[model samples]
Target: MLAGAARPRMPASAARSRLVEPLSGETRLMLRAAQLYYRLNLTQDQVGERLGVSRFKVGRLLDRALRESAVRIEIVHPAARLVELEDELTDRFGLGGAVVVDVASTGSEQDDELLARERVAGAAAVHLASLQPTGAIGVSWGRTMLEVAAHLRPGWTAATEIVQLNGATSQSARPTRAHEIVERFGATSGAAIRLMAAPAIVGTPGLRDALEQDPSVGETLAAARAAQTAVFSMGVLGPESVHVASGYLGATDLAALGEAGAVGDILGRFVTRAGGIALPSLDRRTIGLPLEELRAKTLTVGVVAGAGRGPIALAALRVGCVRVLVTDEATASWVLDHA
Candidate 1:
């Protein structure tokens, strides 16, 4: 597991609730407390000093010669040997943390790229599952997040609140990929569901403002904005982007954005090389939390990988849109090259 730098993750909820169920309750409690304090890195106070016995015994256990040597430490090597890459990314960006995945072997360059995306997506899935996140989780829509949500297996993150950070778009008669991604997250985590029933980008700023004030949309937006942790990915400026394929944007719009020096996006809102919105007119009608709102979140994570994304990833890091990142070796190297 790659721990993000500096930012606090949810404490081990599973460990805290456990109890000694056997006759020697005192002995078991002391051992568990010692494990928490020494091996698991919980603070001494978190092991509970109240009443003295737990703390005193735990202190004694910590002083024992074994010092957790009895417990075997196993290093499970991943397909992508990337701890060094992950560490480099975090150190360079001053990120909360980073997860770097090794690509599955493939015969062709195209196949390698596809496998790399899958590997990074899988890593993101594992990291999110590790959070065992409680309370509200805000999510953004795009190919990258879709990849992460698709790879997520059934998990123990029970009864979480998952809200979409952006509105939905429909290309065909089927449900939008954005809705599908958020729904899968809720189902995998066994969380409560709240979906936004609006378009991602409206025709005009007036229409966008009106929809933002509509009670149903407004309430969902408020819940997402108030979320303690959020997971999103940037959409690069291109024809193959999820927005274009999902009918949220057209080629002309992309061309216009490129002409105006747009690089990428957090939700539907676009940013430039310097990372702030480059096109005020387009952003005025975009329906989602603004860049500043996302930047302020401590646990906001960006899960992205692959081509034509390095510039945007760098911009997102520089702008503080995401505190944590899950990526692959190639993309990580590319970002470092430009850094």
Candidate 2:
């Protein structure tokens, strides 16, 4: 019969297990054919030789066996477990994406935590490198972000520009190679670095506003505003946090912010429990991309890990601080469990 435009749909039974487990004696010729070929991984020639048939017939049997759904296949992947958490984060937080690294638990809890952090950093580095960045990438300075930069391999991105999202030229209480972090990012991505030459936090709002108008600072801010992707991390509120350790804040100041409901710091600004800046006065003195601006960027990636960061990480996610997240399994589980 010549083919026609309208053909009757094949019945479901035609493509079921009827070919292998035949319903009638007429279809039982290949009953054990798929078993001999697929189960034993036999070559078509070998299957044909054993069945006393030509290789061509053996191939036909295998094709019919597939159409009849005789053999079912499933693939298992090492990273399959991360997909569940990834989906939950996407559905729960409306995030662009999530990358969760599963690090094996070590005998020592303390050492395991550190090892997980390093693995997360390495994963973040790989993720960033995979971007093939072509334009301005705004990066803020922080402990986690610095580690990410350190682990980044060269040539992950090309013909790119690395913009400093916040002012970071000021002196820290302790020695911190903050600039080195941005430099490594540039070196790895083959991007040119645009340093923001100003204090991260100035003495007064008036002085901070004045510096914003400076030609160099204005250039850096413009680059940041035009950035296509921005990578940053949240800072925990504690004496040992980089912010406090670097003298961005004193112990007494942290106490005051906590008293005012500050849960953590992002981009040097304290975040309240309600997901707003904790203190307006402190924000005024902070020299960085405005919170609203940072949030509005298309690709704001928050790279963080560790149990202690869960509360702040959840706070940031709730407030639309970051669109993507890269962290270890423990941190992801913590955020999902606690958030």
Worst 10 residues of 1 by lDDT: 64-73
The reply for model 1, stretches above 4 Å from the true place, is: 1-81, 171-175
The number of the candidate with the highest lDDT is 2
lDDT of 2 by residue, 1-339 (tens): 677768688778777765776366424546566777877888988888988888998888778877887656654787777878888987889998888998887788787767877888888888877756568999888777778888988788874799888877746657445688889998877789988888677879999998888888988998999997888877778777777767777777888888878878777788875678888888899887997998898788888877577778887887797888988777788889977
The 0-to-1 C-alpha lDDT of every candidate, in the order given, reads 0.78, 0.81
User: Taking the candidates one at a time, how many backbone clashes does each contain?
Assistant: 4, 0
**Which lDDT tens digits does candidate 1 get at residues 274-294?**
877878988998887878888
Runs in model 2 with CA error above 4 Å? 1-78
- TM-scores for all candidates: the values are 0.73, 0.75
- Candidate 2: deviation at residue 307, Å? 2.1
